[model samples]
Target: MSDATRPDPDPSIAELEAQEQRLTLTRFTHDDAWTLGSLLVELARQRQAPVAIDIRRGGQQLFHAALPGSTPDNDAWIDRKRRVVERYGNSSYLVGARYRAKDTTFEASSRLDLDRYAAHGGSFPITVEGAGVIGTVTVSGLPQLEDHMMVVEALERFRDS
Candidate 1:
C-alpha cells in the first residue's frame, strides 16, 4: 500500500510539525538588556514582591540584583533557571514542557523528586545573530505565572528594540 493509504501511528504528527516550526528564538541587542532589567524591576515592584534577578553573558554575570527580604530559595531557582535556559534557550516554555512530558524529569508524584531541582519561574536565553546563547536572565520571587509574565514582557520589549 502507498504511504498515503497506510494508517499513521502517530496521532500528533500535525501538531508536532507546528510546534517545531514555532520553536524559534529571535535575537536581541545590548540596549535590549537594559530595558529587560528595568522592566523586571518594575514588574516586581508592581506585584509587591521582592525579587532576585540575574543576568549572565559568556557564562559570566552581567548584572545581579535582589530586592529586600528576597527568600533563600532564589539560589535554587537561579540554578534551575540557568539549566533550563541552557537546555531550551527559553526558560518559561521549556520549564513548562518539562512539567508536562510523560517520562518527564519534573514528575513529583513519582519516586524521583524532580521537584527539588525543578524550577517554575522565568529565565531566558540571550542570543545574537552569529552567536547563540551568549547569556541568560533569570527572575524569581513572584507567583509562577507572574514570574513568567515578567520575563515574557521583558523579551517582548527587547524584541521591539
Candidate 2:
C-alpha cells in the first residue's frame, strides 16, 4: 500500500476510551497512594529521570515529588497535565490524541486557560468504581509520550501486584 493509504498507528477515540475504562480501580485509598507513589518514584530513579510526580485526591495532594534536575517548569507541567486528566476524565495524552485525531486543538474547544491546563501527557484520572474520578496522578519532564507511558507502566505494575 502507498504511504498515504497506510493506517496511522495512533489510537482512535474508542481505543482511548477503552484505556480509561480498563485503568479504573474498584477502590482507592491513602494506602494506595503510598504504594503507587513509592513505586513511581523508584521507577523514575532507576531510569535516572528528572521528573515531577503528583498524586492527589479531591483537592488534597497525597504524594508529590521532584527528582534531581526537575525544575519549576516541570512542576507547572505537572499541574497542567493533572488538570487535563481531571477535566477529561481520562489520560491527558489520550485527550490530546483525541483532539489531534479530530484535527482540532484543545485550547480552541476547551475554553479553559491553556497556560493553566495542558493537553500534553503524563496524567491519569483516579477513577473509583462507584465514586467516579476523585483525583489525578501526573508526571512531567520527559517527552509527552514517554511521560504518559511511564505513568501507565507504573500503574499497571501496581495494579497487578
Candidate 3:
C-alpha cells in the first residue's frame, strides 16, 4: 500500500493511556526539548533507523531533525501528529487508539482535514504539572506503534533523570 493508505500500527487506547500517565513530567523546558531530541536522534542512529524528530513549545519550533534516509513526507507526518497533540493534549498515538476503540478514525469522528490532523503515533504533549500542555515532542518514519513507544521510552528516561 502507498504510505498514505497504509494502516497505522498502534497499541490499545488503555495501553497508550498508561504510557501518557507515566510520561508526565513535573516541568518541561526548552533545554529538556534539546535533550529529548538529541536522545531520540542518537537512538535512531544507533539502530540505523530513519526518523524525523521535532520538539515544539508554545507554537515555536525548538528542535527538528530529519535523519538520514528520511523523506520529506516524514516532516509532514510530524506536523500532523503534533497537531493532534496540540488539539487533544494527549499523545497522537493515544488519540488514534481512542478512535480505534470506537472503531473509527479521527477524520470520521472529528471531520477534520485528514492531511492537517493525523491521529497517529509519535507526537506527545510536553505537559507540566499546573502548567498544562506547553508543547509537543514528535517522531516519525517508523511503524506508528514503534514511533510512539520510542517517544514514551525517551520521556521515561527524561523523567527519571
Best by TM-score: 3
Candidate 3 per-residue lDDT, tens place, 1-161, comes to 89898865546667777877777789877888899889999888998889999999997999998999999999999999999999899998888878877888787897888889999889998878888889999989998988988888888888898
Q: Is 1 or 2 the stronger prediction by lDDT?
A: 2
After superposing candidate 3, which stretches have Cα over 4 Å from the reference? 1-10
lDDT value, candidate 2, whole model? 0.87
Clashes of each: 0, 0, 0
Steric clash pairs (candidate 3) = none
Q: Which is the better candidate, 1 or 2, if ranked by TM-score? A: 2
lDDT at position 52, candidate 3: 91
Against the hidden reference, what TM-scores do the models get? Answer: 0.67, 0.89, 0.90
RMSD, one per candidate, in order: 9.1, 3.1, 5.7
